[model samples]
Target: MAETIVVDPITRIEGHLRIEAVLDNGVIRQASSSGTMVRGIEIILRGRDPRDAWAFAQRICGVCTLVHGIASVRSVEDALHYPIPANAQLIRNLMIAAQFVHDHVMHFYHLHALDWVDVVSALRADPQKTSELAQSLSSYPQSSPGYFKDVQAKLSRFVASGQLGIFANGYWGNPLYKLPPEANLMAVAHYLDALAWQREVVRLHTVFGGKNPHPNFVVGGTPSAISVGPSSQASNSGTALNMNGLAIVQDVIRKMQAFVEQVYLPDTLAIAGYYKDWFKKGEGVGNFLTYGEFPSEGKSIDDLSSLMIPRGIIVDRDLTKVQEVDLRAPEQIQEFVSHSWYDYSTGKNAGLHPFQGQTNLHYTGPKPPYEHLDSEQSYSWLKSPRWKNKVMEVGPLARVLMMYATGNKPARELVGMALSKLDLPTEALFSTMGRTAARTLESKLIVDEMQAWYDQLMANIRAGELETFNEALWEPSSWPAEATGVGFTEAPRGALAHWIVIKNGVIDNYQAVVPSTWNAGPRDTLGQDGPYEAALRGTELADPKQPLEILRTIHSFDPCLACAVHVTDPNGEELLQINVT
Candidate 1:
């Protein structure tokens, strides 16, 4: 007999998640991943000033807010045909890299590590040994035994200080998770260390953005004034020689690069040895996709000479031969709301781009929709995005594959080194484990690249390359009567696309195809699973009550449901409703 098992209120990650599994005795049958809460962000965005959308959109996810801000501005810039300054491009890339470091460190240590390591186990760790480990890994004076003792002392104080907010609802003593006491202690110490490191690195965003989490960024150009003298405002005209703050910014970048190399990278490798089993599981959706990122050079999409991050698509696990990515190319990309509550405008097919979307409501049973792609038939608010109408992977794994396929020397070298060190086959880089490992490896490369960009900025500054324009002189009356534009950017998750239509200087209509929408959408009208869905199929569930493997695999993608990212509590007590038979 088959019975349903549910693990609700999944912990230690962003937002909430519910995992429902079907089991026959000890064997698994099927699984359903659910996001149980809803807050209408789209409804909130409607009728608001198009200019203010960035402010609200950034708040959609506390983790990757700056990414959303950039995506939003890129959309508006597309509509306005605005050209950003070269220096602005470099600054944005640097900010993005800082966020990458901040996010990855936080995710690995605080969020994901908690699932693998026991915080309480840290109390028994030998502080002197940990300091020795740190020092042996790097020649830094800060990694001495005394340093780890202070770190342990701080952790104790943190728990006693009523500031265990980050550890609320944590399950450190759970028998289901297997973690060595020593490893646990090290992770706990690093957790505090990372929190401090992330805060310092995140300031890069504040330098350019004026703040972190959500900063004021304009589409055409930055809302900043540069000054060469005592004030940066004078440099707004692009001719000022304000090298004061820029030097400080570059120095910080150098420091961060050192930390990622000497600290975070080593930590990841050391921890990987403890959980070598992960190398065998969590591989999903081999095909990867990336919309070229970091546009600075005058290069076209096909010619990435000018862009800091190149845009392209990869398939068949081949990243070498990239094809031009055109949203209007064909009907390859489609959306299915059948399983969802949304009323499908088309009964027979997935919604096509530009005109395709969902916003209707239907109350089906509480169970997930396994048949139709319509939201009315589905359980998730996220719409499934498909490439060539098939689920394709997107994330660091995909990005790295695409980069390597394009012969990115730095990424290739790092990936090769990681694979070799892990004692895994090089071919394994194309699997689920590859995707997770790729994220960490790519981060190391980006850390170095950020420093490279900093050096480039120094060269340009010395060579008299400066920003001459600050404010955009706008005449509302002279604004176009009607216009349409497409904005594409490489978000931290993957490629994000937004299309906007404006009339009389006001947004007539707006639509966004978020990264999670692509990674976690319901089936399209054709009954095709999105990337996450396809990856979920065939995954083993040893215990229905606690399917840690599946959760790790899914969360490995780092999904952020921009529309609604909440997961609800199952409340333990089951409610039974009787009906007349």
Candidate 2:
């Protein structure tokens, strides 16, 4: 049997993944990605009110909290031809932008950074030298020698405690780790700093949506009203978003922009400099997909043209040409369950559009305590989704490439700056390290734009336009008998879309083709490998017992197993369990 590796997410463990790799002469010859759990949220959504869909759908992935809700509400609004107020659009933009910045930064410092940084190595670093190195990169305030000493001390205590926890001193002597002791210590300090910084940044969500980790979202517009102007009620009086709340949001945006500019962007480039060889490997299937998001003022949610991140597709790593993406067209987007634990009314080989997607459970693998999954048959729970019969990669890499190909001036400039700073060519953007770099560059671009979104929202308040919810479609009695629509967003992880079919004011069918599923799915009917499988094929594992290289490439894609493999039974019974022997 080939070696089976179970990779768990940093935040959660139950919803994890397994990978089977065939090695030939120290290099991976083939790979398979298996989402161990199955998602049944779509099955649960059937026969529910379309307007209440966001509340339940938002629970799909606790980490990617707001995007699902946003997509769910927009899907219903699209089916009902709902148009929200301009102020509402700006608020949603701010909320979504906050989600992006928050998600990316946390992923970088907490999850992916450890793959390249060795925390145990930090114990050998000189605090003064680490401080000097940090000062040379960016003028972040916590670059003092004393600050480094304090961080090193805390990290040392954590390691010596013998209860390392998640930030444990893992892989102490791994040879593949390229960063120096000073660099590692600097990264470790920043990781702890980000943990504290994230607390304040999330206040933006609380100020706008009442809570985080699934903030409130309505189909037509925002859940809160504007309580602006001095003559009106004070801030936080009832459900109105007053000036005080906006001020808090503005402060959070400033903090986010500052952190990205000083910590996240510099740290990424610094780490990439030491691991330049990674740029030559880990390229996925040369196709990219992005569903545009953050529509400008007075623009429809379905309109991709005016989006901050334009919707488009890039094939064969070609930056010169970008094809249009039509989500609603049946031929444009499809999901196949050929190698997944699911059944379709049509044959397994048939690819169905999201509007007609199903969630039938059918596990066809070895029982628990098995050595490995049979790669030739059904393995993963995620169904393979394709665009025009072409396998595509979705996420930060795709978003950056699409923005660059479509000639978005800021995206182009940021990509150029990152490449030039790293002294790498444009073609390097397709590699595993390049994928990680693209994530950082996009974070910088998104954080810089947050100020403008906030400014516009405040400007609308000054103009006395305080309406948030659209009363036009609040009542289900004004609904059509049957309708279908697709709502999409360039989520922090990748392109995410929620498809809804409404009949008699209730959801007849609902499907979410999330980012993780697009990038972490299994092989299709034609025997074509999915993005994760294709990217892992040529990976040269330094040590079979400790395949840190595989983890590096997988983390570059930032796999969210929960998003890909979700679950719940019709009768709330435990569906399946696998015990590793």
Query: Which candidate number has the best lDDT?
Result: 2
Q: For residues 1-581, could you state the per-residue lDDT of candidate 2 as single tens digits?
A: 45445443222222577787888787788888888765678878999998889999888888887999999888988888899887788888889888988888888888888889998899999999999999999999999999999998988888788876767535667999989999999999999999999999999999889999899988888987888656255643776788888889989999999999999999999999999999999997989998888777746666777887888889998889889988889998999988876668888789999998887654343433335667777777788999998999999999888888888899999899888988899999998998999998988988888888788778877888788888987888888899998778878889998999999988898999999999999999999999988998888888877778887888888888777864434455564565543
lDDT of 1 by residue, 516-546 (tens): 6777665666766556656665666665555
Among the numbered candidates, top TM-score falls to: 2
What's the residue-level lDDT of 386 in candidate 1?
Answer: 68
Every model's TM-score: 0.85, 0.96
Cα misplacement distance, residue 277 of candidate 1 (Å): 2.1
Show the colliding residue pairs in model 2: 38-566, 39-566
lDDT at position 102, candidate 1: 69
Give the whole-model CA lDDT for all candidates, comma-separated.
Answer: 0.63, 0.84
Model 2 stretches astray by more than 4 angstroms: 1-14, 229-232, 362-369, 566-581
